[model samples]
Target: MAQPLEPAERRPANHGPKVAARNRDALIVAAREIYATHGLDAPLSAIARRAGVGQGVLYRHFPDRTAVAIAVLEENVRQVEQAAAAEDAAFADVLGVLTWHLTESAAFLGLLHANGATGHTEALAHALVLSGRVESALRRLLPEGHRLSAPDGLMLAVAMVSGAVGGPTREVREHRAVAAWRLLGVEVGPVRPFEG
Candidate 1:
């Protein structure tokens, strides 16, 4: 997507920083809700409408839809980081976090998927980072490098949990990841969502 950075001068000079911040925040929020519900194909004008702003205002704030999608994905990353930090959770829970993100992070998914044909490099990066978090957790959960390569096992786990939904559902992928961890010799308990 074409990115247009805001002219640094347009900010602060207008709302003295605080209101500018509010406006930017509002745009991101509006974009998030829209992206979540409608996927990434919702128009900038629609987001502007949701935010009670003009199209020009939306463009002024976000530059383009990819920028908005990036912001949403970034927030998702931040949330995943926070979830990983939760002391109450098990190491295996990172898969849970990742699964939740994949299932629920629709705006990030939709927008990126919509741009799939052109090889949306940015959205692809976002997905990789999100998936990497799970991979890291799986790495720690497993013993050595052995379990990490269990792609077939992972696919089986997906087929079972999601009925082979053919898309990433958190439970399935995370189960597969943990199974790889097991293949690595970690011995994770049976992933509950697939307890059959």
Candidate 2:
């Protein structure tokens, strides 16, 4: 038999920051997909497997499910900010972006709601920040004189859109978006069929 290798030879040296960054990104993407599909109660092992990393890597990056949830929420908020910041973006555009994200993020949203019901302070705070950010973005799209009532209108519109069954069909989303615009006193005609 051949001689056995030393311990240092058997295992490669750690790449340090690069490996950690890769693992962190993988975990975030995997968490978003799994949470979108299976909600927050999905096992940590599932996220690790989906990310092609071990539990140790996941824990090193995020100590618990709440940390993972917060990271996902932060990424989602970043996307909303980017979409809302487009040049001359209108209220309808912001509504459409919010509706699309909220519909796609049903499981995450449900988890937040459940956590809020249980008085999870961090989860509740994150939810408020999300709402406030969206409202602020929408307010920026309104005319100078119409900014005063934007918050109430935005909250109502978000409530109406987010309460739909199965997160609302595409047609229903379009309808609700128009309704939200109307509620905000912005005149928008019915959605026309796509002609291609």
Candidate 3:
């Protein structure tokens, strides 16, 4: 699958920052392009052209660069949360999602951590809720001790994998992920028998 365009920052000479919902999709696409090209330093004019809108329209939907960036970050988080709802998710499935996120979003992750949101980081906040629900469901599916431990264990496992590696490619990432899973007391793959 092709990678989605990342969101960029834009601050033209306006303050309208609230376009119609119809224009939001286009603006978001353009913002991703601008951000991909220039990181946080992308210009509003470029994004406007990409979205086929004016400076007023850009600001209409996004008051400032930070707001635009945050919106994009939220969108990305929404995508991640969606993936977390798979019916066939396994222990490795959890690692796969975390692995994908770490590499694809190291930069945005830092930005999000630094920017405090009272209740506006809806994507992540939604994630907290989703996680609780998923854990509740899985608690019935896992082993005894593994039951109560899942909620926190799953979250911590992701953190461990993320911390151990700085988002390596899938092949390398899977290896680290499997190792972390073992460290968390969940063994994956067939064990090699040895004669002592």
Residue 78, model 3, lDDT: 51
Residues 7-89 of candidate 3 have per-residue lDDT tens digits of: 55543543334546657878876775566446545787787888888888888788877677666655554544444455654
Kindly list the per-residue Cα lDDT of model 2 for residues 48-152, writing each as its tens digit. Answer: 999998899999989888888877777666666776687755555555666666655555656555646754567668877877876777677665665335447
Report per-prediction Cα RMSD to one decimal: 10.2, 6.0, 12.5
Residue-level error in angstroms, candidate 3, position 109: 2.3
Q: Each prediction's Cα lDDT score?
A: 0.55, 0.67, 0.54
Per residue, candidate 1 scores C-alpha lDDT tens digits across 1-196 of 9989778976545444456666676777788767656667777877778876668766776777778777667655566566555665454554455444444554454333444564467776775665455454444443344443465544244223322212344445445455544444434443432111
Query: How close is every model to the real structure, measured as TM-score?
Result: 0.54, 0.70, 0.48
* Model 3 misplacement above 4 A: 1-22, 86-102, 113-152, 157-196
**Candidate 2: global Cα-lDDT?**
0.67
**Can you list the residue pairs that collide in candidate 1?**
99-170, 147-183, 147-184
Better of 1 and 2 by TM-score: 2
